[model samples]
Target: MFETSLSGLLTGRVALVTGAAGALGESICRALARAGAEVVGVDLVEGGACDFVADVATAEGNRLMVAEALRRHGRLDVLVLNAGVQFVAPIPEFPEEQWDRLMGVMVKGPFLAMKAAWAELTGRPASRVLITSSVSGMVAEPFKAAYVSAKHAVNGLTKVAALEGAPHGLTVNAVAPGWMSTPMVERQLPEQMALRGLTREQVLELLLDRQPVKRLIGTDEVAALFAFLASDLSSAVTGVCLPADLGTLAS
Candidate 1:
């Protein structure tokens, strides 16, 4: 267990994290909760310690999320638009359904969540919005066209929201993770390895080789970056997509 160092980082803030049931999402929730922020975790599947259930991609879901946030904490101070999906398929054979799913969760989800929470975020003090993007947004990856495109859109949304939030004292930014050890990657690893006719170990080796550190980035590491962005310490940082890719983006 990581001891909390976020004593007063977000002392009395309230946070809403979409896709909060996932490994990465849960980590971010834990980080914010430890920082003294009241966190409401939202996921389509729900469960866990999540305070609410909202789809985020649909108008109704978005509205429910905002309503739940207000009902739970009275005011929304942090918005973590982190709901997304990864579809592994080549461009030519990519499923249109997968593309729509990815876009809905990655791009549209954030837009809706931000839109629904706009008044609350802007009306609060020291409000922050953080999006969980990916290295794919900054670099190319094999068999993930939809995920890449959606991530790229996430950065665009981040920039636009940052600019809009600037005058209102709200900061918006993104943390782009590399190959992290999470269920999402593990599920795709076997299939991706089979596609390349390589063993699972070899596939991991291929991923690690791209990183100068030669290791997989941890979910907690990505969570730490989110923690930083959500804190007042990063008050001057916004409209930027910081890659936590273990140097993968450089190569």
Candidate 2:
């Protein structure tokens, strides 16, 4: 249902994407590049797609990455906060450290990244900040207290940034995706199975039970949405968390 050619849509623009080593992040980097943007991939580790390695959960790391991008690219036009970490467990059973780590990566990371890139992004011809949220941000899901809470906070942050950026020609938005066929989701299956005392197939069934479409989402599908939001076509679309959930929220 997505258009194929976004070529030249973002020509001459520079984009910085966090979590560039991961599958979804890599896909986003590719999509943005295909759209003609000069994509700079950032991660905590090095990868083929990753250009810089830095922990985005800290203020200093955010500052360093932004500075490096500006140093290399000379300008910053797109910022994609796609870095994420998932820890699943009941609220009481969740580890304190894991909770802190999850919040740091998903919540604080985006906030700090945006803050660091604020000046560079604002007053530009067309600057965009796109966050990677999740369906958990829209609805509650069990065994994901930290993840759900972090995404909810991110959704709120997206709106606040959008409001502050509107007058400056800077648009801030987020993409909330549903179950995707990524290593992250694959890792969660075993945890869900053990927690719910279900088989692997049963756990998969349970994950898709709420959605009208009985399938996993593709990274490219979500990336396409991001590409659109990052382009001039979506200039009027800000402060919104668009879902790429395969009708999960619609149901």
User: Which TM-score value belongs to model 2?
Assistant: 0.98
Residue pairs in steric clash, candidate 2? Answer: none
Worst 10 residues of 1 by lDDT: 1-10
Instruction: Kindly report which residue stretches of model 1 are placed more than 4 angstroms away from their true locations once superposed.
Output: none
Kindly report which residue stretches of model 2 are placed more than 4 angstroms away from their true locations once superposed.
1-4
lDDT of each: 0.87, 0.94
The residue-by-residue lDDT of candidate 1 on 1-251, one tens digit each, is: 44367656877888889888898999899888888888999999866556677778898899998898898769998999888788797789999999999999899889988899899899887899999998888877889889999998899999999999999999999999998888999999987887789999998988788789888777878888888899888988999999998888787
**Model 2, span 1-251: residue lDDT tens:** 34457788899999999999998999999999999999989999998479899999999999999999899889999999999999989988999999999999999999999999999999586899999999999899998999999999999999999999999999999999999999999999999999999999999999999989999999999999999999999988999999999898989
Identify the leading candidate in terms of lDDT. Answer: 2
